[model samples]
Target chain A: MTALGHVPGPVGAAPPAPEASRRGLSGYLLMLPGTLWLAFFFIVPTVTLVASSLYDPSGTFAEGYQMTWHWQNYTDAWSEYASTFLRSFLYAGATTVACVLLGFPLAYAIAFKAGRWRSLMLVAVIAPFFTSFLVRTLSWKLLLSDNGFIVGLAQALPFVGEDFRLLATPAAVITGLTYNFLPFMVLPLYASLEKVDPRLIEAAGDLYASPFTALRKVTIPLAMPGLVAGTLLTFIPAAGDFINAELLGNPRTRMIGNDINDLFKSSVIPTAAALSVTLMAAIIVMVLFYVRKAGTEELV
Target chain B: MTAVASRGVRGWLGNHAVLIFGLLVLLYMFTPIFVVVLMSFNDPVGRLGYDFAGFTLYNWKNICEPYQLCESVGNSIKIALLATGLATVLGSLMAYAMVRHYFRGRGTANLMIFLPMASPEIVLGSSLLALFVNANLAGQLGFWTVFVSHVMFCLSFIVITVKARLSGLDPRLEQAAADLYANEWQTFGRVTLPLMMPGIVSAALLSFSLSFDDFIITNLNSGQMITFPMFVWGSAQKGIPMQINVVGTIMFLLALGMVLGGLLLRRIRERPTA
Candidate 1:
């Protein structure tokens, strides 16, 4: 489920016709518009962000920033917002783990058990997306409200008090993140699990391997590409997400995204740019490390 | 015989354990959606609009009662339509090029397409803001800026979706069409386009949804204009109108209808003719 995994076979695999390969000019022509759009909006903007990060910190929107190339902006932003950055990753990590746990059984059942209802089940999984994201998150706020049933149920525990609440806590932010991104995990997992040959599992069972053992050994290894893809998809967006934190979390639970947004709004352009660049760089580094460790470099 | 029957019952339960668990997860996923639907009929007595005060048809009947809500919805629809159209056409052409014809720097082109998906929205939004700021377009940031960004991000998804469909096609079908003495344009129009329609349609649907629901990037670029998500965000800070839930419920119903309608159409088409 890497971005290119949808494309069949290896890159530059045999063209359908010899003339297809020779018509490179047409290929380039077809690519030109999209390529130029990406270059202008994606690539150039990214470069501008890096440059903005180096601008003089003292400058304001009114004063206009100068190209001071001040390297300390990185250190300044990092030193000030390190905890927020760490919290974002921690929340995102927890959300990814939660999504995997919740999503796996659903994806598994949809793939192996649903039979004729598979597509319907898949649509059901994505149906939540039809609603507005904010509205759904708002419903979560209702669910986790202090006087809500969920909190009342939580307060019933022996260790919990009547005052126990789910909202305005780190738990709330993480729950919101997990809920929002669960489909990302499930869809990829379903895609890969759907491809797993049923005969392989039957073969394992015939070999006297227990169901759990077969799942751990046979099913999981085959679904690694989707697992890796799903986790990255969940983690990357969760780390950068501010809506969950802003809506569900208290001020103390603020993530890097919240800080970056606040900084940008307050006209601290250089610091905000610095934080944005740092977040992107950190995510890229972690993704590379993860892809390498997962031994699925080819998928990417 | 009693013991054997008991063992068979146990086997049935064991087999269904995963299915039961999966159903519970699905329930959890749909709970909020149910809440949104339920809230559309809520006659809230307070500003928070958190609880179901009383069930009434007022919110649904007067959906446009809230100031600027309908206007924002209109803006979102316009943006979504335009962005989806542009992204689908450009992306399908690019996907066709990538899959049907081999070219230099294909690897680099693929990487360029993939990078935007990998990057977080915060980074993407902030970087674009930075670009506009530096380019002296900060004052001009509004609908067009948001539209450009929407197309920019939607392009990658469209490419991937259409590329998957294009590459999955049987080359022999096109070759057969050519063997029948069909011209290039004729072969493409009659064969390739029809075969690729499902992918293109899906890509367009995906792009429309993404553009319509976008907030993070839109929030950064939308200086004075209010889109639906932006309006929702603004209301979240102040007071939420119950009509917002009405809008949410409508979007949900519309999309679900389209999907189910498409599925029914496909099933009809796929049925063996007597």
Candidate 2:
């Protein structure tokens, strides 16, 4: 075939500059499969969920529920699960703050301080995640149990009492959330931090700024995009997470996700759907507000 | 002079403080993993209790001794592989289109791709379940439903990963290929596709892991299907089987091996090429 003949060419031939092809039909054609997949599976399902949330509260699936445009379902759901919603946000906020505190240093060390070991440290950061998440959370259960070494260590600490238990408390839930989502925070921080010029920090040092001042003024501003991204990533999922609460916390620490999950299980589909939609809307609003306040427009 | 020396020492300690704190954080992250690995070896005296007793290899030796654990693992692998393949293919094409072409609705397309990642897992899972229930397909929720959800979630991640790699690529190489009188197909097959391999590979790996590790979404839509995560959840309520740790350890080692192996292979390839 003549087509095959064109494969081998003169190796050193200086080819002409590549001409920009017209914005043709192939691009749209190429996008068709994936876009259709997302549209059907993601977009359609989301619409269906919203519709289901408006179904009559009194009607079961077997009884053929009608969509009466019930906005009251949201109100009912909210009144029933408002505390759970507030608790989810609280836990998520705490987790996000904790992740920032823990992940920033680790990400900074990997980006700037690890030097030749940077790649290895990066790998190490993600290596633990290869284990199943449930398993990891379960191990946390073991580690935080009353007689575990972690509890013993905490008991030995100056502020902590001998009677303080870490497991099945809000502290345990928040700890699990922080641990599980820390990588999400770290990876983005690393990405943004790696791009910052070392000279800026050096210049700050040369200008007689202390290390803390240099970090705050020079490094933190440059890493804002990553920080915003990291916080959003950490907060959103942490808010929705029932796994940590279910495994690590007592009923007192249950979050909105637990309520949604429980409601769905109990065949309260309309209420569950309403709660899910509310959770998503609340998160989106918070995210939009935070991103605007943080002044990072590139994330979307 | 003493004050000056002490100040200098204090500053140096402050400089290295972040690194020390970082290492401590790393240690904290690995603490539970160590417990899991250690627990895997523990021959617990009772029915899969959390307490560590004398170490033995019995769990490793009889990983499938627990009822349906191996079956669920097999199901997870099957679903993960299927979802990864489907998502990677679909997502890479979408990423390619987004980056390489000046398409209309690009902004909307980007938003669509991003929405799933931004949305909570609970919403996504419940929505899919709701869709199935409304369509009267609720009774049929099983492997196929789980498979579909896995693909949906994994698609967003794949698209993002590959798009990052695609956007960063220098187009000059493809231009050079075209300048050599190569057709679009030849140029793509020879230059563009080869260059995008790393992105595609990483995306596939990400997709596989996401699908494999997903619990919340799978739990909602899976009906009676017991993927590994669902199995773990079910078992956690009853006594957890010690064999789960063996599986966990194996997954960690295998993933670590694959990543390191990929790095090694890339290094080997780049050495001569460079």
**Runs of candidate 1 exceeding 4 Å displacement:** A1-22, A157-159, A293-300, B1-6
Residues A65-182, candidate 2: write the lDDT tens digits: 7899899999998898898888999999999999999999999988777765677888888887899999999999998899988899989999998799999999999999999999
Total colliding residue pairs, candidate 1: 0
lDDT (C-alpha) at residue A95 in model 1: 98
DockQ of candidate 2 (2 decimals): 0.54
Q: List the residue pairs that clash in candidate 2.
A: none
Provide DockQ values for all models, in the order shown.
0.64, 0.54
What is the overall TM-score of model 1 with all chains considered together? Answer: 0.95
Question: Please, what are the lDDT tens digits per residue for candidate 2 over residues B1-274?
Answer: 9999999999877766777888899998888888888889988988587798888999999999999999999999999999999999999998888778767897788878878988889999999988998988888989999999999999988988887786667777887899999999999899999989999999999899999999999998988989999999999999998999999999988999999998888778889977
Maximum-DockQ candidate: 1
Candidate 1 docking band: medium
Candidate 1 residues B1-274, lDDT tens each?
Answer: 9999999999888888888999999999998888888988898887456678998999888888888999999999999999999999999999989878868888788888888988999999999999998988888989999999999999999998998788778777888899999998898899999999999999999999999999899999989999999999999899888899999999999999999999989889889872
